[model samples]
Target: MRRYGIQPVASITDDLDIAPLLITSVGRLLWRYRSELAPVTMLALLIGTGTILHSSYRLWWPTVAGITALVAGVLLYAGRWVNLTRPIERAYAATATAFAGGWLTTSTAHGPFTKPLPLVLAIGCVVLAAPWWAHRRRRARVRVERTLAAWPDIAQAAGLAGSRVQSAIVDLWGYRFRLGLGLGQTVEDAVAAVPRLESALGSTRGGVRVQPVASKKANRADVRVIETDPHANAITWPGPSITFITQPAKLGLFEDGAPVRVPLLRRHGLFGGVSGAGKSGGVNVLLGELTACPDVILWGIDLKRGMELQPWASCIDRLATTPQEAEALLRDAVIVLDGRADDLAQRGKRVWDPSPARPALVIIIDEYAELASEAPQAIDHADSIARRGRAVAVQLVAATQRPSKDAMGKSAVRSQMDIRVCFRVREARDADLILGQGMVKTGWHAHKLDAPGKFLISSPDHDIPRRARTYLLDDHGVHTTTERHSTHRPSLDAVSVQALERAAEMPITEDAPPPSREAEKVLMAALRQAPAEGVRINDLMRATRMRRTWVYQRLQDLARTQQAEQVSRGFWRATPEKHAQ
Candidate 1:
């Protein structure tokens, strides 16, 4: 038994010869824990450098100190480039570098392990290692490495057998990996296998996401796994993000905390979401911004008896509560539109440039479906404005519970919207209805939004399907913002005011009333000078500074008195007897 197994060693060697193997194993173990052993390695390197410098080039210690000072200075401002993202991280890096460099410089001039120097090095190493070992991002990176090491098997089980991870980034909310798909494989395949991949990676349902790399290619995908959700809580609205109508309206925030800003200038917007999905909250945020702009004049149609837009009534120039009033408001807006258009044409300008004197007009319609059902006529004018208003700085911002074709019927008003914000919807098809056709298939799954303010936007500049949330301006906040900005609000310019006055002075129908002495005189003069054939109602109205109804009433009186006569349908002329006068 004593002679058995070749004394537990190779046949040509004794057991003592196994020392080399043991040493090699220990070296590999140390290398495996290199990050944890960093402080010790640094200390040894400092000692070695000091020993060599003291023996050969101790005079270079001052130069070492100067070089260390310069490096620390560079790291102060440029540390972000090296992944020292936070100020504290930069401070720690600079401090560590300075301490190590200073110790080496002092040790080089004296002895390698003099007096309190060794003790200081030991204490400093422990202190620095504490932060390094407990860093959240560092731990995330290590976990990512371990997870990636098992990715080959995970990929095989998840139906992506040959794909390989090209790169990865660990962020605050989650980690993402850039994948290189196998030949003949596609991003669709990866997307289809998302559930399987989530299970294989030990992530929750809906935790795994796959997006195609924005290229003309289908073989690359970016897989994101959410370990934490950044948008789980309500983001408090930071006051007015912009003070002018020309700036983008800062809405809420994206998942990465970037502001969701969509320009409101000269753009018609639609916000659609179910009840309690924060559609009103979204409108409140918009009102907060529009009220702050002196170059913007706001009008609102709150068909819910002004329940929704009442708090900001102070800032709104006109608020329509009933369907009749809504229709009249839109009609007046058309008059303003015509005036602005004619003005621009005369000046040879293609667009209405907004300013304090020539402010832009923004009409906010809450529960637009009610407007469609109650004031159907208003929809026609709204459609006209939507089609032609962008150039003249007259735009609509309508919010509705559902934007179904029936709810937004006849006008195709939904089609003209330039910016769309969609909140939580009831069905997969509803997302398409609110955003556009096939939006759910394209990854704008508004039905999946978990919170009230969460939404998805589709705009000219943002064509991709990224989820967002609208800023929540509560009742108190709304009142405060409106009151603060009320004094700075701009009035309607002269052109717009005259256009509205011309409309207001007009009678509703020819049968309503008789004109005053001066009004009657103006009408009689217009009829007496009418063209031989006839003068159109519009022409007579414009010539007499009256409305269509007013012109008709005066013409009717003139005809009855033999001072005017109808030459044809919708045409009028002065009679021979009247010409004699």
Candidate 2:
């Protein structure tokens, strides 16, 4: 029985030995064909070496130390490549060279116990490929720079100055300098090279007049050129151009630099122009510039189905599209103004006191005619906001295709909107309505603006009207600006919509019949039991828990219904018809 047990034990030991040998053979075969198997085989070899050293020496310190160093070194080298550091690649190459040399020396010294040479070869191969990868990246960068350098000149020749230009390559950063004529050019050359010089001049109804500022003494080249209010400051080009200024030069400022820094919101401008005269586009430019100011809170109203102003919905705090919405917005603004005025009166503070904390509110309206036509009540509210809103730092900028006195009634609203912009009106009378009387004499005729987005700006303080360029907002600019300031959008939810619907559907309580009609039948029965007069308005209100106005109106309505009569201002008595059968 002992001999039988020993035989079985020996057989198990042989099977265990043969199993490892089979595993090693299969692992070596896999490592020969698959590159991924190199790391796996190295790990297995590390484990086998550790086991052998632990059992033979009864100590695993050397094996553990060697394995740890190998692991840490491999990870460090791999991390360098992952980080894309060129210097680290050089370090890896150096380490690989030293390792190959050390391995060759060790293998020659200890022949049969030599480690795997294939893994060393793989590391060396990866290190050798790094220079080619770095060279390809450098070439790609140079090609992008060359392509971007050519676009600005092409855009200028195409008459696209002062516009944002997009390039196919995103990494190109130095495209701004190549937009216009290069250095050492004369004034004539610069003007001639500028795209659409004639069109730009003719669109403004002004002749191009360039003057040389100074010339370089040694090179005899014109160093500077100035165009006299030639209407190129805010002109829209076919493509994009980088902007250096936040606000475009006002007509007065461009003419003689009078009112050097006019407060845009304080001016309380009104925009009036004919349809397709770029009135909405002008508002877009104004709002675009204003949004960059962190202090300003923009509000917008568009009664033309909201298409013109929806692009800027993200930047504006309030956006109202329908007449009811406009009325609500105006009423809310009026309430805010009144509240602010009351607070200021209490605090002994005045508006326009140059306080950053009390920033102005700018309400911009698009298609004012439609708003007036839909909600006639909004006219008085808007007028009130215009008249008294300025005291509380509330301002209005209303735009309309028709500037007739009938459209925007000739009242305090029109007179109070001091700053006005007129673009391509159908008649000289329309321009007169927008730019005061006889503005056509001062070159403020809308017939002159044949261009789509051109307009003439006129103010009470300016001596003469000047044509100001308008920018056409493309999709990309709108998307980018809106995305950047998306937090300003009004917070609307399903609950708010449902609440609005409920309010709209709710019956007017003043128009509703009194519950006393039903109560009167009971009261009449009680009266039949014991005759008495009708109930007081106060008692009715207290009994029904209705508002005082509602109860009073209901009592007046009851008098009309022949159910009650008011004997005095505060007294009521049941009528004979009401008491009779």
Candidates' lDDT values, in order? 0.83, 0.55
Q: Model 1 segments beyond 4 Å from truth?
A: 1-33, 51-57, 184-188, 212-218, 505-507, 510-581
- Error at 368, model 2, angstroms: 0.6
lDDT tens per residue, model 2, 1-581: 66667543444554466878899999866744343343345445544543455455534454444654565466456645544345654465455444443443333333314456446545654554455345544444454445444545543653544332232221111111212233454334533433353343222223422222233222121211122443434444232221211233332223222321234645577787777777877777666666655545667888876798878866776677778668867766675566667667878887643232445567898877777778889888888888898766678888987756677754677778777877787777878788778666534556566555666665544434444556666667777777765543222222222333333334645744444466545433432333244444445544555433344445545666887775432346667666674
Please give the distance, in angstroms, between residue 513's alpha carbon in candidate 2 and its true position after superposition. 15
- lDDT tens string, model 1, 1-581? 45664555446546467789899999978866776777789888888888999899989999999999988877877898987888998998899989888988888898778888889888988998899899898788878877987889999999999999999988888888999998889877787788899899998877777777767367888888888877777877789888888999898887766889888888999999889999988888888888889899998899999899877776887778889768878988888899899999999999999999999999999999999999988989998999999999999999998898778865478988989999999888988888888767756678888789998899986776666777767777877887698778887787887676566565655733444677767666777777787776647655665544356556656777888897754568889785896
- Stretches of candidate 2 exceeding 4 Å from the true structure: 1-262, 352-358, 488-581
Q: What are the models' TM-scores? A: 0.81, 0.44
Q: What TM-score should be assigned to candidate 1? A: 0.81
- Extract clashing residue pairs from model 2: 163-240, 163-241, 164-240, 164-241, 165-240
What range of 10 consecutive residues in model 2 has the weakest lDDT sum?
169-178
- Candidate 2: residue 124 lDDT (0-100): 50
